[model samples]
Target: MIKAIQNIFSIPELRRRVLFTLCMLAVYRVGCHVPTPGVDAQVLAKFFEGTEGTLLGLVSAFTGGALERMTVFALGIMPYISASIILQLLAVVFEPVERLKNEGEQGRKVLTRWTRYGTIFLSIIQGTGIAIGLQTMRGPAGEFVVPDQGMGFILLTVITLTAGTAFIMWLGEQITERGIGNGISLIIFAGIVANMPAAIVNSVRLLRTGALTPLVGIAVLVLMIAVIMAIVFMERGQRRLPIHYAKRVVGMRNYGGQTSHLPLKVNMSGVIPPIFASSIIMFPATVANLVDVTWVQTLASMMTPDHWLYNVFFVALIIFFCYFYTAVTFNPVDVAENVKKQGGYIPGIRPGKPTADYIDIVLGRLTFAGAIYISAVCVLPTILIGEFGLPFYFGGTSLLIVVGVGMDTASQIEAHLISRSYEGFMKGVTLKGRHG
Candidate 1:
């Protein structure tokens, strides 16, 4: 591992990319501390203290606590994520969008441009809503979060937040083009990871104060390690379907007589399911926070993260999205057609509709198992917080994002090292691509 670290810097290109990514991340972290104008930072922080089970807390986690401090980056990259997801769903529903999706590189560029436009629109809407909501919000001592409540404040906030989000989007794109790993996912991973030191410090403080017993603290540590191991194991899990290529004669040689396996990942949908689930389940709570109504507040309170209703709904939504996203992203019919075009076929299944049907069946079963795994992981943190009273700040959704993004970044690093004839991080180990 030490050698791999050295090797990364040995390659100048890789070193430059790594440094550029770090600098971009530093910029994001710095933005997280820049306060938005016309807001009482202390009061906003105090307001967020009691929102651990609310939608605000969830958003705060993704923002690296920027929302808690009402920073200029309080909106975070969520607007971009929302826009991308919306475009993906449109691709599945709208014929024109679907055609654009199938048009290859040019199509992707157009879609990406549209996604940026959508991100700006969503940022404007969400920024306005947050500005209005902040004006009505109060801390425990009844102090308003936003000191100035007027159309001017709202307009200023909207413009500031929208501009902040746009800048962040540009930063992410620059990192992707000139740096290492996925820019957007790395930004989110950085946000979640930024809170780790605070969580550790809080845990230690609790342990010192005897609020957290040594035994429970040890258990929490063990559980976290176990959960991380399980995540790595499950994320790398795949079902490989054997494919045989028919022999073909070229002008002077024989070709296409080979066997290869198609690897279908267990968690094909990745972190989208849990994210979508969280957003949908937390929508009512967000609305309740924005609109002050006795019945609505009561309903949202009942849907807290620790509540049984919330868990049930959360699990159901995760399962639904796992299958829905998997279907949208992976079309078995397209795969079958491609395989047929390449003169390849699954050993037992005939090439065409039958193969597509078989692949779909296998995918459905895998999606079910993936959904179950995702639900278990996502709900475990809530269970620990609620039942065991553990001050576990890292939720399951954040864990998934962190681990997934970390693995992807590591893989990219490993690829660079190996391409340059250097040993990878896991030298003499079978787990190369699988572990990354």
Candidate 2:
């Protein structure tokens, strides 16, 4: 590992890219600390103390506690992510969007522009909603979260948060274009990771104060390590389908006689299922806070993170999105067609429709198993929090994102090193990405 680190810096371009990515992340962390104007920081913090089961708490996790602090970056890059997901869904159902997807690089550029526009629009709406929500929020001491709630404060907050998100979007683009790894995912990874130290400190403090029993603390530590190991193993696991390419004569030379395997990851959907599940399960609570209906509030209260109903819905949604997102992203028919075009066929499977069918069946089974794994991982943390009262900052979704993103970034870094005639982090072993 030390030699690999040295190798990375030995390559000037790689070093520059790594440094650039670090600088951009530093900027994001800095923005997380810059408070939004007109909000009472103490009151906002106190309000967040009781929002662990609410949408605000979930959003705060992604924003690295910026939302809890009412910072300029309280919105984080969620609106951008929502926009991207919206575009992806549209591409599946909308003809124009599908055509645009099929148009190659130019089409991709157009779609990206559309996503940016959608981000801005969503940011405005979300920012305005947050502003309105703040006006009615009170701390545990009955202090208003917003010191001066007015149209002026609302407009200023909307503008500030919108601009912050726009800036983050730009930073992500820059990192992707000029730095290393995925900018957006890395930004989120950084945010989740930034809170780890605080969580650890709090846990230690609790342990010392006898608030957290040593047995429970040790169990939490063991669970965390075990969970991380499980995640790493599953994320790298793949089902390799054998493929045989028939020998063909091109002019006087034989070509196309080759054997390869198509690798389908155990978790093709990655963290999307958990994220979508969280959002969908938390939607009622978010809406309840906005709407003043009695039944709605009751429904929201019943759907807290610690509630069994919430867990059921959360698991169901995770399973649903695992299949849905996998279907949207991976088309067995397309893969079959591409393989056929290259004169390759899966062993024991006929080319064309049969191949597609076979692949789809395998994928469906894998997706089901993946869904189960994701649900277990995500729900286990909630169980711990509810039953043991542990501070689970490193929740299941956060773990998945951190591990998945770390693997991808390391894979990219390894590729760069190998391309430059340097050894990767591990000798004689290649790191496979999530898609593989």
Best by TM-score: 1
lDDT of each: 0.91, 0.90
Worst 10 residues of 1 by lDDT: 427-436
Query: Any idea what lDDT model 2 has?
Result: 0.90
Residue-wise lDDT of candidate 2 within 133-192, one digit each (tens)?
Answer: 999988777788887878999999999999999999999999999999999999999999
- Residue 52 in candidate 1, Cα distance off native in Å: 1.4
Clashing pairs in model 1, backbone N/Cα/C closer than 3 A: none
State in Å the error of residue 349, model 1.
1.2
C-alpha RMSD for every candidate: 2.8, 3.4
Segments of candidate 1 deviating more than 4 angstroms: 429-436
- What TM-score goes with each of the models? 0.95, 0.93
TM-score of 1: 0.95
Alpha carbon deviation, residue 52, candidate 2 (Å): 0.5
